[model samples]
Target chain A: MAAADKVDPIHQFQIHPIIPLHIGGYDVSFTNSSLFMVATIVLASAFLYMSTASRALIPGRLQSVSEMAYEFVGNMLRDAAGKQGMQFFPLVFSLFMFVLVANLIGLFPYFFTVTSHIIVTFTLAILVIGTVVVYGFAKHGFGFLKLFVPHGVPGYLLPLVVAIEIISFVSRPVSLSVRLFANMLAGHITLKVFSGFVVSLSAFGAVGIAGSVLPLAMAVALSALELLVAFLQAYVFAVLTCMYLNDALHPSH
Target chain B: MFVTSAYAQEAAPAAAEGDTHAGTAVPAAEHEAFPPFDAKTFPSQILWLVITFGLFYLFLKRVVMPRLGGIIDVRNDRITQDLDHAARLKGEADAAVAAYEQELAEAKVNANKIGQQANDAAKAQAEGTRKKLEAELEKKLGEAEASIASIKAKAMKEVGTIAEDTTSAIVEALVGGKTDKSEIAAAVKSASR
Candidate 1:
């Protein structure tokens, strides 16, 4: 309650529906989160589209960025899952751009972070796990379960190893979603808290205002760190997606 | 209207705070649970994520990937073609150098052969001229020797006659006479022998 005198660090995460709507007994109202998503889609898609519109042999700066994004995701997928994993290229690319754009856009003041919500990240994580499951079974049938069975384990320890593998497997989506959400939430909160210190500190007197620079400096440093996190988390999400898809493609190993 | 209301909601809390610290002014929608964990927004966020992600996947797959990949493929193909062209030219250049060297070597051999023939011809001509001069000098020396022998024989015969005449003159002057010419010739012959 003492923090009430300061900015609510949680204020930025609030989601009030911009256009309240009811669809099939669901509160599917367009919230600020949705607006940011729309913005992300438009911006990412437009960047790719316009940047490569000319498709120049020697690309200009924007085109180079777009191309690097393509290669960066492409190489990450290829390295993790091998050439055959390229089938999930669209899925991986979409997830990377979506998360990346959303996080970057959220860094702007008062913009809702779509990825900071558990449901959003969970949905993405589930989608990746879901794709792995569906595609694994569809492609490899019962052999997909071989993912749990090790190649050269003693029969005595095999049961324990399999149990651990299964537990780890189940935790993948949880970890994936929580990692992104918690990082963004914690970073944003910490940043807000620092800025809050500056605000609350300045109110005391002339000396207080001058001393607020410490927290202000901390906030600036935190902003730089958050920028790194923004990109890194997106990359992490995509990388995990690729690894999961790898499981689908080669469930035996 | 939505923006205005949201702005109004944001302004209300700060206005009530009396202190002008707008930095900490809380949002209007204070939840019983944390805002992020609030279940009410789940459906909307999930719905939008699906719709947005689904649409995003489609757009990338259908549009972006192909175009970007097209340019890359084009560039790669162009590079490959250029390299192949360059390699071919290099091969051609190497072949040309090889041919030039071979021709130079052949020309040198031809020049050597021609020079050898010229040297042999000159040598043979000089040998012929030397042999002709030697043979001419040999013939001239033989003729001169034969003439000398003939002249010597004639002088010997004349010397016999002169001996007989001198013997006759001496005898006639000193010892009364030109007697015994045949004997004098015999004497002269005996003495010359």
Candidate 2:
């Protein structure tokens, strides 16, 4: 009791059901995580909707922002997957906006971090890989497996190379999901721990308050770094999706 | 494999300490899965994710994409049209300038022609006036000379008569006799000659 209580960084990720409802015996109860997810959708959609609703020939500030988001995602997809990737623009845009807005919304105080969960990130990763798989097979048939075959490997080592390629291909979803999830997870945890250091240190009196400045500054710096990570992870996810779609489009080597 | 076990190890100590800020809120039962990894919540999260994300995707596809893509397309089209218009205007302005310069040069040539004609006319009129004045002066000089010559002839005739008469009178007086008029006349004429 003489010291400040221990800070619980994991507590931030706890999900509390806001509206407990059952749908077809499934626990589809609306939770805080779901609330944030809905919020992400609303915010992203509203921003895109209202900002561009004016559709000014000369875009205003908000319109420019919305346009930039569109162009950013559009360029990323086209660059990674070429013109054919334009077909997947909506999917890629939705995923990018969802992840980005969710990450940013999570950054606010006491807001739920929806993407911090393994399921959500995994589901998103699966959606991308799923699209790539379905489209690959649908478009290329069994030839889609050619992605596992490199063009220049010696015949004797072909088996080894293809095995490696297959493993690498399969690992894409796991890495993709983990990358976004872990980045958001670790960054938030670090930010909280550093902030907790400031809180716990400042509890010890004047000297403690003075000593807490270091951790406070560190937390602030980590926050800026987290903001960068949020945007970067979303970009990584979208770009990777484009590349995967590219592999599907041109399954040779 | 890695995440679950690591989370277990890290969260075990925190759960045992029972010093959690919101007690029993997250780690409800001893067997409750970690909230992030909890299977029970997966269905709900996935369901809601499917529902909300589906809605989000539809919204972006139906509403957001068309509007955003349209605005961008419009702006680009507007920019291209504006540039084309500007180029056209520039071309028109250049044509107008060329025309203005052409008219200016033509006007300069016309003014020079007019000035040359006027200079030639003034020169011709001045020459005619000078020639007319010279002719009048020559005629007046000729008339004055003719009149002077007539007066000189008349004066010379008068002088001859006066000398003859005087000589005749003198001769009569000296001789003291009245001579024949013809003979006196003949002698006087010879003496005067």
Local accuracy of candidate 1 as per-residue lDDT tens digits, B1-193: 2233444455565446433223233444432346688786788889988898889899999999999889889999999999999999999999999999999999999999999999999999999999999999999999999999999999988988998899888877888955888887888789879
lDDT of each: 0.87, 0.84
In order of appearance, the predictions have TM-scores of 0.82, 0.73
* Top model number, TM-score: 1
* Residue-by-residue lDDT tens digits, candidate 2, A1-253: 1122235576678776667777777667788889999999999988888888777888899999988989999999899888998999999999999999999999997788999999999999999999999999999999999999989889999999999999999999999999999998888888878887887888789999999999999988998998999999999999899999899999995
Give the poorly placed runs of model 2, Cα more than 4 Å off: A1-8, A15-26, A51-64, A78-84, A133-166, A195-217, A246-253, B1-32, B70-93, B133-193
Model 2, B93-140: lDDT tens per residue? 999999999999999999999999999999999999988988888888
Chain A TM-score by candidate, in order: 0.96, 0.96
Runs in model 1 with CA error above 4 Å?
A: A1-6, A156-160, B1-31, B74-118, B158-193
Q: Chain B TM-score of model 2, please?
A: 0.56
TM-score of chain A, cand. 1 = 0.96
RMSD of 1: 6.1
Q: Which docking class does model 1 fall in?
A: acceptable
